[model samples]
Target: METANRIVLPAMDMNVSEGGEIEQTEIDHYVARAKGGAGLIITGACAIAFPYGAASMKEPGLSDDKYIPGLKALADAIHAVGSKLCIQSTHHGKVARIDTANDRPVLAPNPQDYSYSMKAMADCTPEELAKMGAATAGKQTTFKTMSKEDIDWLVETWADAAERVAKSGADAIEIHVAHGYILGVFLNQRDNQRTDEYGGSLENRARLACEVISAVKARVGDSLAVIVRVSGEEYGQEGALSLAESTEASQLFEKAGADAIHVTGWGRNPFDNFTDGPLPNKVGAYVESAGHIKKHVSVPVIAVGRMLPDVAEKAIKDGKTDFAAMGRQLLADPELPNKLAAGKPETVRPCINCYLCVGESFFDDTPFCAVNPSLGNEKVLPLRPTSASKHVVVIGAGPAGLESARVLTERGHRVTVVDKADRLGGTMWFSTMTTPDNERLLRWFKQEIKRLRISVKLGTRATGALMRELKADHVIVATGAVRPKPDFPGGDLPNVQTGDTLRAMMLGTATAQEAGFVLSTLGKTGRLSGLTKSPEFVRQFTKYWLPMGKDVVVIGGSLVGLELAEFLVERGRRVTLLHEKQQLGLPLAMPRRWTAVKDSEAHGVKIHRNVKVDRITEKTVEWTEGGESFSAPASMVVYADGTTSAAPFAAELEAAGIAHDVVGDAGAVNYIHGAIHSSFKVASEL
Candidate 1:
């Protein structure tokens, strides 16, 4: 509680428990972050009673003393490293996402008619819509208003949890009253319309929150800190829960013996929640919420939502909040605080705020982080140097290759990474260009590669002789995925190129091979023929886009195709995307897909879904949609669809008798999450 930093790990629902008991996965997880040096680590939001108002299935619970042993295990593990622990106690209330009531109505202050997911149904495909519906199926969508006895009983349950939290050796207890949960709904005018003394007015609405705080404080005395987290404003209809109302509530909570506050807000749009998805900005995503609360609350305050160290430090200095609560950032790099303290902040890995962490929770409710591969499965993470160090050769310099080389070096192995492209980032160069948050990560990877001093051979392709020449004890093939090959008729036409090639060409940074292919096209016939020999001349020459004309038809509906469509549309080109899916970008991360879909639609790029391509000619594409054949005019056709891996080097490595493991897209077309996580796991073992 007293030593290293002011950063706190806020409570997140990482559904990893079994029947309300902690698993080793959860233990290893908190212990790793505790060991990595967070000042205070809060356990995932633990529910009080079961069978009603539960936020998630298998959420860690404290309804009975029988659960204390598991809670004690987590608290002991966190405290073992001299870090303090805080147990977050909550009741899901109306925002309960699970059905624990055995088909009985889920209790709430009033009828809980709908969820934020319901609002997006009109915009989603049937599959996506079904997912949203399934998320709330039997989910206590309607509520019977809480009676005075029910409210008092819930407060008692909260107090019981607090007492158990203190008994379990935790240093504090945080009451979750945010994100449209029970207490948060009670604090909102839009949700609570009862005329009783427990509702209808600001003071009456705040009474329940104050009572919970008082009850918890009475149980813990001064032995534990009492923290209350709240939504600074309801994001639904205006005047629901205004800033003034929240400030008043904060004051009431302080007067009721609350020790601190964590300020976050609900979603204005269903897609724009407390999570990172659809958030217009990355850093300081919710500073205003916390800052407003700090002005009226005498106790310490914490702020979360993608607040990096620099912004966090500034916020604390400016008294916006006493501590910056980091959720995803700590998951991305547990050593963030250590790096900042050591004045080595540049090495700290950043959270790209892709919402994969949050999205995974919605899907499987597991402990997963896109940037950090070792979150839930921390037992497999290496803690010491390997027993024996050997030379390791990694092919390709994409995320997979570099991650393998980095981890292999950490295990005391000598590593050499080779890539055919001159740049360090493979397809990420194009990806990072669109998502600026990833650009920083790209720079960090490049910097780490330099810092590690691992030998890198860019623009060097590996073959059998190269593998045999290195004589490595192990070889890792990360020769990442290539664009899907064109398989339709007329695919071999000169006017067709893949998305990767087109992106590189448009950026004036085409690979050596691609440059030659483009330059050779104008040779022997046009005035620009000989200019291709000069790099600058050719780069400047291609902007006129000799091979790719103004009107282009991009074929494919995968993420690649959608992103390519976004890029081309932004560049002021007339573009159309043809794919087989009913909706083009349904499977991408919420934030990424939202931006791409909006950008593509706003630019007037036509999307032809469920289309069948019959043939592609030099300047035209023939396709059929809804059983009607139509011909689309095009100057060039870019292929972005396909999920296949092509690693010609595998045969060479096999013939050379080199021990090799294929990873990333080379083994199969794994996305970035799968590619990076599996590569790190494999490299850690080597």
Candidate 2:
């Protein structure tokens, strides 16, 4: 039952199964992490009832012996690499879509009464809503209160599932009572209103979970270890399980023979409070809760929720928790553990915490990492040596260009990266001021560039002559997207700013004329110096002093615009955001996008959608929506729009007869995710 180390890969759903059977894609996904040196690997949620109580058809199942071969295959593969495998067994109670699809009422502790806000879905397109609806076959969810017989069936089902795990040769079986699953509903007072033995006091509410844990342990004996996952705290719901109740529950679980307690948190409202729990956006989210539970229970406590390497190491060293369950970090770089063990932690690619991976699970689709292109599809990841190494010139030192150079060097190709900007991370550098998590990625890329010894030419713009002089066998143009000034009336006002101009002003790359008097005044006040080059310093320094006035209006509400709006609002500016379309945060993943909109609104950012800009005056922005004229007072107007894909160098390379390809925003404007994925695709081939 013991693992090689304290690092555990907790259950992260990979909706890649086929009718309750585990496919090789899922197996390969786990195998890659195992090979990458994770001490313990836990499979995603496995339905004990299969198609009957499953959330999606892609979820692995343990209802029948027919599924044993798939589980055994995964177990054997994980064991081959000296890592222990733990199968997470669960019954997706209220969220079970299969039950709704078959016109069978999904099991719940009681009839559902609470509902979450749908305002977050206002920006979702018809296609996105349709894809989410397809998960449940477009059927309305109905629930049936679990009877006494139903509770018996559930306990038997969990025990049977654990027995199959032992038969499949897994090291442990994790009984999932967390994240609003079957046992979780009975554990929480918010969902469980029944006055029966299963749902009254704290112990009564914990009865079903302890019963199932004891049953599973008895059935499996010592052949397999038993782990129980519980929500240390539930967010966005009244009367939900708190840290105190969950800590006592952990003690009860230990008495019921749970060898380990995996502490997790749940956000009751998926749309509004996702970042507050489960996959939390904050670092070390549940470490404190897990540490509290550890003091009450004698067994090991596993803490999860953005458990990055440094956070996990400190928690373990300080005896805060027994193990750190990393889900997204391992997905970003499966080699994280190996790299850490080798004392080369800088090589570990960091998960930017963009929520792109978990967003796919909302639609019942396979999750993929933003930094790692080969997540679910791992077979395509190995850096195969090229038959002939050639000199390659990658234009622009942004994410796309840097990633291309890194991959090409791994494939034994000589690469030279050239950029017009003085810094490495083009627009991504500016993004660090708004979203600090991006700083980790920028630092990682910088370290990789230094580690790989790749040639980088900053302040050197790429051209056909430069490529010819370098004698490049291949050329990759990643100059990124173009942000032109809007063609509307008064768009050229002195107080107005475009994306390029805004970035330049923030980075201190703009001239006094381009930045106007306000920014020039700030520069003359000795604020713009060598220290301003650090995004961290500027981000903090701006909270006290910003060049812009108190009132600001941002046009366009997409990813960049929304983030900028939030940033400006947080900086004490009365911000009004206007969008031409209904979607506010397009191209950002659903969860993160929903969070951005909700947070911006909560913070008093005035958001207007489906609006047409009529003009931008010196101190006001005029727009029309639904045939109604509207105007907002603004001291500074930022036109964070008119961005289009433009790779002018591609045509130049073409005319010169030099082999080349376009990647990143130049090929299409998907931002960072598109940048990394596109660069990897093109670079791997070259």
Give the per-residue lDDT digits (tens) of candidate 1, residues 1-686: 35368988777667788778878788888887788788999888788875356766678888888888988898888889868888888888765666533454566788854445442232356765556456566344556689999999999988988888888888888998777678888888877887898789899998898999999899889889888888776664655678788888999999999888888767644453333321324578778878988988788888887778899989999988889888888888887877877899899988876667766555435857766887777766664588998888999887888888888887789999988765676766556544556666777788889999999987687877777788878889997877754898988776777856654553454544553455434532332343322334443444455554578898887677887677666656789889876666655665456556666777888988789999999779999999999888887788888757877887887887888888888887756766788788788776
RMSD of each: 4.7, 1.4
Q: What is the number of backbone collisions in each predicted candidate, taken in the order shown?
A: 0, 0
CA lDDT, every model vs. true structure: 0.75, 0.90
Q: Roughly what TM-score does model 2 have, to 2 decimal places?
A: 0.98
Judging by TM-score against the true structure, name the best candidate: 2
Estimated TM-score for each candidate: 0.88, 0.98
On the 0 to 100 scale, the lDDT of residue 180 in model 2 is: 89
**Sequence-dependent TM-score of model 1:** 0.88
Clashes of 2: 0
| Highest-lDDT candidate | 2
